[model samples]
Target: MSQSNALIIPGLKVALVPCPALGDTTLLLRLAWRLQAAGACVTVASVSLASVRSYLPGLNIVGGAPDVVALAASNDLVICAIDWQVTVPLSNVAYLAGKKLPRGFNPEQPPVLLAGRVIAGAHNVICRDPKAGKTMVQWIDLYAEEVLGLDTSLPVTGLQDLPAVAEDADRRVAIFPTTPHASKNFSSSGFRRLARCLTARGWLVEFVGIPAEQQKLKAEYPGCTVRTFTDLKGLVDFLSNCAVVISNDSGGGHLGSLLGLRTFTITRRRGDFTWRPGFNELNRVINPILSFKWMGRTVWRPFIPLRRIVRALADVKVQ
Candidate 1:
């Protein structure tokens, strides 16, 4: 028989089921750390645990419905970071109870949110940092305060101290040139030009992509260096060491925000500006529309001029 909570004694057992996005997993890592500090044994239920396991280490990683349900039933606290675009067991409270629980959630704080809402609303449903204001990256502290009941003042240093990064203003430039969706990959030619543009100016440029894309990038641009990463930690370590990051509003971009890199996300969606108001001063985002008046007419153009991005980052210290 599996060990029961009785054997584990008073240590709190918590399960966090996050949206199956790398960005969400990175954010959930923040939440997981808080729970662990509060004496909770945290389990992450996910299909996307390979990268997470590599970064976090020793986490109780699990997937599939039966395993997730059993883990949730056994745990003292169960939380699911709901991404409405996807389906998971925590979609509704009934999915947890296998039947509906009492539906008397306070209307003011509607249960539609991930931490507090109408469906799979667990002990708490944390909505995307409320309209009341908080940077997207900064809200993790708020969640720690309000949800995990941890002291709000303590700094969130990592398990082991990260090695000191280079202090040079002319350090490497990290670029993630691909997005999961093709349409969102700002411009391939533009990214290459930017990398070459920066590389020629005495800055080492690092490009990241899938194996195939990396191969293509190397074949196309034989002179530049392109590194492919399979784990999130490697990605983080690389980005952490870089002066700045440029990406197409993908998970890597979000991770950059978490690490407080001067990340500039070039996007196709106009709504992303207001929707993903990032967590800090370093996490600035922009699109061509903000720079070019003709952008609204050619918004659907495959290529956005690199000059627009250059102008936007004019004030950024691109060492």
Candidate 2:
């Protein structure tokens, strides 16, 4: 498992296929940045382009496996972070799956990433699921260091690496109180109250979500500014101008962390360590409950006091 001699060639073409989830896509950016920094051409292929493309400004991204086939045909390597039903006809494929928690898994340990059977007859099937506590970004870093033999000790990217956006003169806090799953979301009332508290503190508060949920959120938080975007770029541009991001266990937190913005991610499960926004040192994960189960709805989401959230926001330094 030692990668002492493994080295990436300059101008090497690589295609990375990550899980379609926005958080997963954001996590994979670290690996992509490493590859690109080493003079390797990196492209991310996923179905959730609208959710991820905004954050991936410089990296090339294709829609899915269909688009990847032509691109991978010319690329030197193709790495997949998820199990693919359709295989790319490439000789040098790597399967990097099983990074998420399994059913009835030990809540105290990191999720296991198994190098299952090769899907596209891969030459290099590399995965390392050390039981040690690690975040999703760290898991990818392990894969790069141990599997690909790449040096990942130093920080790969900073705010200077991203395209510059003029910061707002006023301190703006983008609040994303929604997640794909209802169980992961804190109560709407809790979010509304949090927004009002920020407004009272002379901070500009805004609620962000997809266009489909725009009307609903506006109705829920009538006084607050509810902004929606149809594409990831719009959201990314909006987030770039903000000072801090407060969100549920969702992509908003992940995106904010990737942008090197101070993010306070509210979670229901302490076991979601792998899913936390770990790219930034200033990022904080606040949990209302300890258990990572159905009790999150009853015991956790319903009881997240506004004071706790305000306290968490004030605790972090803005630098």
Predicted structure with the largest lDDT when compared to the true one: 2
Q: State the displacement of the C-alpha of residue 122, model 1, in Å, after optimal TM-score superposition.
A: 3.6
Query: In candidate 2, which residue pairs get closer than 3 Å at backbone N, Cα or C atoms, i.e. clash?
Result: none
Error of 1 at 54 (Å): 7.6
- In the range 1-319, model 2's lDDT, one tens digit per residue, is 1333344555778878877677877766678888776667788776665355655566777774535456557777777664552343343555455444334423223221222222222222222343454667777776676656576764564323344666552378999988889868878888887888877776788999888899899999997899998776677778888878889888898888887678888876563466677777867777764443454434676545458657866654433
Clashes of 2: 0
Q: Cα deviation of 55 in candidate 1 (Å)?
A: 5.7
lDDT of each: 0.58, 0.67
Off by over 4 Å in 2: 1-4, 46-58, 63-68, 87-90, 98-131, 154-170, 289-298, 315-319
lDDT score, residue 183, model 1? 64
Query: Candidate 1 on 1-319: residue-level lDDT in tens?
Result: 1223121222667777766677666666666666665556778777655444545654677754325556546775566553321234333222221112227623233232222333222334344524544444456555566544455464543334444676763467778878777767766677878877666656677887766678887876667788877755566667778767788878777776666666777776553443242534766555654433374543443445566555555555554
Q: Which stretches of candidate 1 lie over 4 Å from their true place?
A: 1-10, 46-66, 82-135, 138-153, 159-170, 219-222, 270-280, 290-319
TM-scores of all models? 0.67, 0.79
